[model samples]
Target: MKDTLKYMGVVVVFLLSLASCTKKWEDHFGSTSAQKTLYELISENSDFSTFTDLLNKSGYAESLKASKNYTLIIPTNEAMAAAKADYDFTDTAVVKSFVGYHIINSIYNVNTGVDTVKALNMRNKYVEFTHGEFDGVVPTQSNLIASNGIYHVVGQPLKPLQNIFNLLKSKFFSTKQVEAIASFDTVHLDGETITYHTSPIWISEVRRNMTTESRKYTYFVVDDESYEAEYAKLKPYYTTAYEEGNTTRPDSTTTFFTKKAVLRDFMVEGDLSPETLAAGVVSITGTAFQLDPADIISRTKTSNGAVYRVKHLTYKLSDQIKQIKVLGIDPRGYKQNDKRGNIFFRDKRDMNGALYQDIEIYDHKVTSFYAKYRALSMTVGKYKVYGRAIMGLAGDPQTAVFTQYVHFFDPSIVAVNEPDLYKRPVFNYLGNADTRMAFEVQPLNPNEVYLGEVTQDVYGNMQLLVMCNGTGPIILEYLRFVPIIQ
Candidate 1:
């Protein structure tokens, strides 16, 4: 009887021990876990030297210790390096502001196997720190797990919500004002009134073409009566900028805003321009031409009346689209006979060079699979300039000079009237690796791209003549630059 009793006692004790272990694990990451003092967490994590110093300097230590309902997204040292790729990371004020915003004064643990935090109304209460989204929040480097807190990895120092706009303006883009004479807000180009927020690619293009004088003061509708009054008030903002000496300089920020906010008041207000009003004030810069003072692209009507969004500040658009287009050239083309004046295509079976051979609409689903190399080029007659080819390679003529090449990513090519043509059928010349000269004499040279007018010929055959100067053979890849249609 005594032996039986002893065995039963052993089993009960073992069960109790297992329960305790499970409970301890759950409690480690419970809602109360983040209540530990900051000094205690920092003392254990000596590697957080820069972060700790900032916390101390900002006098955030006492505040953090006193708080119970907060979540802190701490970053490691490596995260700091990744964020400040171009700028020096040693700035004390910048680093402090960055880390400060990452910490929320709420007692929440993301590591807990639970959906949704009471703080973020995010689906399932989970906060995401991804790029191209979530402007106010950021992700940090290294996900740190502690008895009371969680840490995330970041590449750059954190910036507070207040400084977020300024930081982005300084690095990625800034705003600018664009002024033009008035006209109707709508136009049927190929079709469609492409107002509202255009793709970033198109915005970049407008920035490139704008001049200094036009960018300083942006024109918007204040009704026909207010045009003169508003223009006079806004004229002072247009003074010629200077750098060091007396040389007049261009303002970059003003030019960027002119494109980003395609319709001056699109986001802030809805469509403002209605035909009911006879004559009204409008910002210019017409279609097809960069300098013409034309019509307003977008307008909104509010209780205050009609207000148009004009490009006032400036920002340079990205040239990445040109780069992406080069990468999209069909590698399968290299396998075809492409002997002379051969039509290129995306699929080996299709050779008509269908309008969208290598290019595709910016649908995330389709493009993810179809795109290739990031850019493309060839060494035709020695000169190497980047191709700003038109959509569909519309114009190709036998007599046309070698001024452009087809960009693979976007359905476009850059061609100009080339002065020279070495052969009649536009015979193929493969990039360096193909040496047998199997492909037609491709025009673009490696490492260089052209920035001049690129037009097509009547024949629909691609042709370009360039002054190429680069060491390597030209390459081709996929990239797209959506034009800003206003």
Candidate 2:
């Protein structure tokens, strides 16, 4: 009996040890067991019930229940109630957008420094995270981890700011004031062909390439009537910009110029105030216009931005479109190719800090030499013509005798009466003021030489000609046409 009892005791002790080992093994490995999901966590808190309902109505509840990682930047119920006026909770679309604004696709941590972290939200808009805060609101509570993802709580709801591009495209595109011109380029990346749309002019230039959420812009959206007014005012100057093979849209150039005229001067850098706008704003392009309080149609608030739809906006034509300056270095074609002269494009700066790019034409080896340049956007008005002709990067400026011709309407310059073709068409001496007008470029070259004043009869381009009777080289700089506002 004693021996049997000893064996029993050994077996019982062995069984106890085995049970303890099994318990420890289960505890270590079972750490992978499931816990509460992000939705469940939000559901547990009464303060987050508004967001919970939004997630459920948005159909995002099902997704958040899964094992995928997510980051929820949710606002409290009190916060939602305050912003309730801005949204219609009954609309499922609105609910979806609301929930999407709060959720991020990946796990995002709070920023530690002054630098901002632009986390893309579920709705494809950027959530600006700056110094542990997002959407200009610091989180009431944050870094709360759940089984599926992480979440942060804020006192205010987050709304993604519509960038200038988005605002311009979504709100005012129908006004026909701005066109999202699309151009595609195919690029090979690692033997794979990829294509993407190029940046439109509004985004690249007017917005100044500030595509980030950190930068704020106040876009003045012009009303349709005002847009047409500006277009009408600017159309006469852009008549000569011909678009070939576009017979269907004969006014394409005019329309494009007008659209640019409206948008280029409308965008201001910051969220300007009504008072400040009323006082007036100036564009970098030197366009100045003041807003009358009565002309403001409405002010619509955007995400950290706003769109002011206004009317009765007008600017001086000279201020709207700066004086036209054509560099002589770029010539369209020779007067006669068979009698072509040797030409060189040279660059230099004048004593007056003006650019004097030269279209040096010499060694023509012919009786007459003519180089033509097409000057577009010349309106039917008086112009003060200015010119500079000097040897660029050559030996010190020497005597250069050349006469210029400003031919309107017809660039062909068909000879009408003269028996000699070169002298007749090239000079255009048939009652044109600037035609056959001679100037000299001597060693004592002035920074700017007043060629003369000329009036444009037609609202279009002026075919400018640089002519020499084959006596000297054509050393010219630039031709500036300043409008003499009546």
Candidate 2 residue-wise lDDT, 54-106, digit = tens: 88889888878888999998889999999799889899888888888899888
lDDT of 1: 0.33
Give the Å error, residue 68, model 1. 2.3
lDDT on C-alpha atoms for all candidate structures? 0.33, 0.67
Q: State the displacement of the C-alpha of residue 1, model 2, in Å, after optimal TM-score superposition.
A: 85
The CA lDDT at 401 in model 1 is 24
Question: How good is model 2 by TM-score?
Answer: 0.62
Model 1, range 315-414, lDDT digits (tens) per residue?
A: 1222111112333344333212322233333322122433332322221221112111312221111212233222322232222222223322112323
Candidate 1: segments with Cα more than 4 A from true spot: 1-26, 29-35, 82-92, 108-149, 153-486
RMSD of each predicted structure: 21.9, 14.9
Top TM-score model = 2
Strongest candidate by lDDT: 2
